[model samples]
Target chain A: MSLHKKILIVILVASAGAFLWMEQQQNNFTSGTDGQSASLPHPGHSAPDFTLEQLSGEGLVQLSEAAGNANGAVVYFWTSWCPFCSASMEAVENAHRVHGETIHLIGVNVTSQDSKQAAENFLKKHSITFPNVMDQDGAVADMYYVPPVPAVFFVDSGGTITSRKTGAVTTGELEQEISRLKEAD
Target chain B: MTEPFITWSVGPFTISAQMLFIFIAAAAGYGVMSLYLKKLHVENRGEILGTFLTSLIICAVIYKLWPFILDPQLLISPGNLLYFAGGPYAVYVSAGVAVIYFFLQSIRKKWSHHSLDSFMAAITTALIVFSLGVKNYGLPSPFSFGYMYEGVMYHAVNFYYSWLFLLVLLAALILVPSSKKYARSITMLTGLVIAYGLAAPFQV
Candidate 1:
């Protein structure tokens, strides 16, 4: 066969393999309903678990422990200096106020970039009540891949990151994610 | 799973994975085309370079102007033009415009089938690299090859495209010396269409 013919055969075989694999997987899932649920896509991967001191100086808060307690956790990384973070704080605070009981909303202050006092003051001035953790070394921020301020990671009950958003988010967006988080179980 | 992609900020510019991929694709395309030209003893480097630049300019213009077209008020503030991302629509529009431009240029230059073949090979290579970089895997799939996003495994549609394109490109490159006038080009084009059709169901 010509080189062209061989290449075409390769493509065909690969495509056919994909189709067959998909079909076989589908059949396996259909045969065992529990298997389907067990194999359900674990989207977004597990959220990087971390421990940080609460900004209120109320001892260290471990992410896994907090996540275990709540239906879902919202890990928000922010710096006091960011105007966008300032703007989004109100929406986050609102979400906390409304869904604090069910959702574990933790503010991770990227303190290495900003002064701890500034972050504390920013929270106080905004009248935010949700627990705020100070990532003094920015380790947690780095782990979460938050370069820009106002990054939010919505983690499900299983500690899987259900969704994430970079930059500022609106009240609606926050609530929408919260609802999705509630249902992510 | 943490930060699957990273964007580097250099001065006022932020280079994302997508942008880097596009650059890589363009470079690869240029190199592949150059190689083909050399192989074919074609000396129309200047014309080919012109066509590439023209396509790039057209793409940029279309991307920037797309938002303004959608929201006419955006035209009032020139700086706002920079902020309005054209997204996929801009890419499609730019590609459409570029194709028309290329056709016109091809006719005007009385280009050979060799030129077209080289152009197709470059594009296919570029596309393969770009797709791999972008990681635009489509809907959730049960297949193990699927990419996991947010706890769900999605069909690696981009990977499929890249793989198929690579095969076609390799075939074309290898068969170029076999006196197969336009056969490789036709095969490549046909393969692209078939691949598109096949991948449609898997796409989101």
Candidate 2:
């Protein structure tokens, strides 16, 4: 009828379309998920405990089932292909050199053979002394529903994921997020 | 199989603050529309809708460009480029263009009331678009707040329900009339925008 009325109708219709578009795409699972939104949502109420065959530098080790660990576990997502991830591990290596027995620093390689070997060599090459796990099927990656490579999930002593990082994280920021989560512990 | 929607927690709160912002925007827009069109003799509903759509574009551009103008660094940083440009800056640029267009119309000394109505319409559209965009980033889906990255950025079609709710509210605001001792529509609009600003889009 009137000009304003016409615009109102258009606005109404556009919003309806946007809504419908959202409803129809509910069944897909790609790289990202609603459960792990970028803006720092919780790691869900329950943290799933998964034990995977980890190819440790010394030998093959089963992570989450590894006995004799004292406090907590740090599961990092990385691939040998990513330079930044390798660089970050150097810092982790340095941290390991300083506090190897005190804390656990485990790197999980995302579905790459070159990176898996490169990661192993990077540790040996850089003298990265901590244990690194190989994620062949991307099972662990799928479990976290991680957004990207180099995702780090910090789990507390009790097993709940205290904090996680999606993109490349600095050693300092990594340390800070871990410490922040420990405040509640 | 469809992924599950889990509860998002930020700070000490559970409910998204983004929802509050969209509501605030709609509330302000509706308030403004109510005041302007109460007794004014207009052509029909289409003209009003067209005017508001133009205004929405204006507001979105204003909101988008302000940050870039204020701080050049945001546009410069490599990673910030895509999302930053898409977010508030886009809204501002669109608004800037709309403003120039409207001003030119005014200079021609055309139907001033008609032009003003069109301006408001543009703003309403921009607000809706910008709100929905922010929500999709998986920060918080206030309107068409598609939850991205809590899972994956779907190349195919995926949707959200909050958008419907937002539209309904917006529709109600537009179709409903105001009566007795009501503040000027423009005043209400300004107040609502200001309140939404307090919600702080960057806070999350």
Candidate 3:
């Protein structure tokens, strides 16, 4: 190839290399796992069921318990370490206060937390009425296809996933989610 | 490696070796692009990259030293070097310096065709270098996602933004003479940098 052609070739190869590297990095950096997140069932797919130790320290709150309520349940995934996750709990509590009894709001707590008591205490202090289930291994989080959280998932009475949000959501937003689920119901 | 280096704050962020590589790659883009300009025998290469690097350093100093930059008696109480990361004016300053750099490039080039690939490569390198800064190595802010699509979109944004920011710089550079090879090269890079910057943002 001529010198000019050589330069052209170099640029094309270099750009292609950069582009490919970028593509690969994007895939890796974004927490992508082939079928890991893809396993996230679309709406209408069966929402996985789980048994979580409730905050009451009494019995486990099974997904089966809320199987057929007129209003579906909202499951929020959070980590004690994340400020955004904590902020999201405040929002969850707020939603509980507004739509008490009508809608079920459950928190799926990740047990990998350094201070489980601190997290629980935060929820208790906030006066959150919803039942919180502990996920020690983060299995439930994977089931929901949750990305680095503060996330929320809405499930219909039939235990099918309806809608979900991944970041900070307000009580009003949760209320909107409830209404949307109710409408779908 | 990523977990301890990473923490959640007011924003979603990343701090791992992989994230480190992205920034390295971006700097490489800067170096490599300069080589190409050299082959094209574009004059004033040092003036371009040197000014660009100097401005970048200034931005970092301002970002980190924001607290000191602020009046001590004032309630704002500015006092650190990492302040630039959180500085409200950081982006504007970086973009502004890039504009000036483009103008410098403009004095040498002819018709600027600044393509997206060229712009993207240079910026990716620049951000990679910024990420390597010792003081404020964590994600500038907290991570968030309201929409399902955002989860996926977030990954692709860094790729797009680096190029876009450079495109903006390139746009500023391309507005000069058209007859000179130096001017032409400068024009192309200017267009690339400016266009890319204009197109990429929310990714950050």
Which residue window of length 10 is worst by lDDT in model 1 chain B? Answer: B80-89
- Sort candidate 2 into its docking category: incorrect
What 10-residue stretch in candidate 3 chain B is worst by lDDT?
B133-142
Give the per-residue lDDT digits (tens) of candidate 2, residues B1-204: 123222235774432234345446555655545555544554443445454556555666555445455445544544433222222234446656766765565456454344354344434543553354333222233333334454434221112223333443355345544331222235335533542432323122
Taking the tens digit of each residue's C-alpha lDDT, what string does model 3 give over B1-204?
A: 121122234464533343355446546766855764565454656555565466456554554443233423222423212111222243466556654655555445432333222333355445534433321211111234212331331233333444444433333333333334345445545555543443232232
- The two-chain DockQ for each candidate, comma-separated, is 0.10, 0.09, 0.04
Model 1 per-residue lDDT at B113: 75
Give the per-residue lDDT of model 1 (tens digit) for A31-141.
665422212212355567788999999998887778778888988889888876876688799999999999999999999999988998999999989999999888777
What local distance difference test score does each model get? 0.73, 0.49, 0.53
Clashing pairs in 1: A41-B151, A42-B151, A42-B152, A43-B149, A43-B150, A43-B151, A43-B152, A44-B149, A44-B150, A44-B151
> How much does candidate 1 score in TM-score?
0.59
Shift of residue B87 alpha carbon in model 2, Å: 19
**DockQ score of the complex predicted as candidate 1:** 0.10
Top lDDT: which candidate number?
1
Best by TM-score: 1
Per residue, candidate 2 scores C-alpha lDDT tens digits across A69-178 of: 53566777777665546545655676556545645677777754445666666667667656776778776676765424566777655555666555445445455645
- Give the CAPRI rating of model 1: incorrect
| Candidate 3 wrong stretches, greater than 4 Å | A1-51, A57-76, A81-84, A91-106, A114-116, A129-131, A141-185, B1-18, B50-204
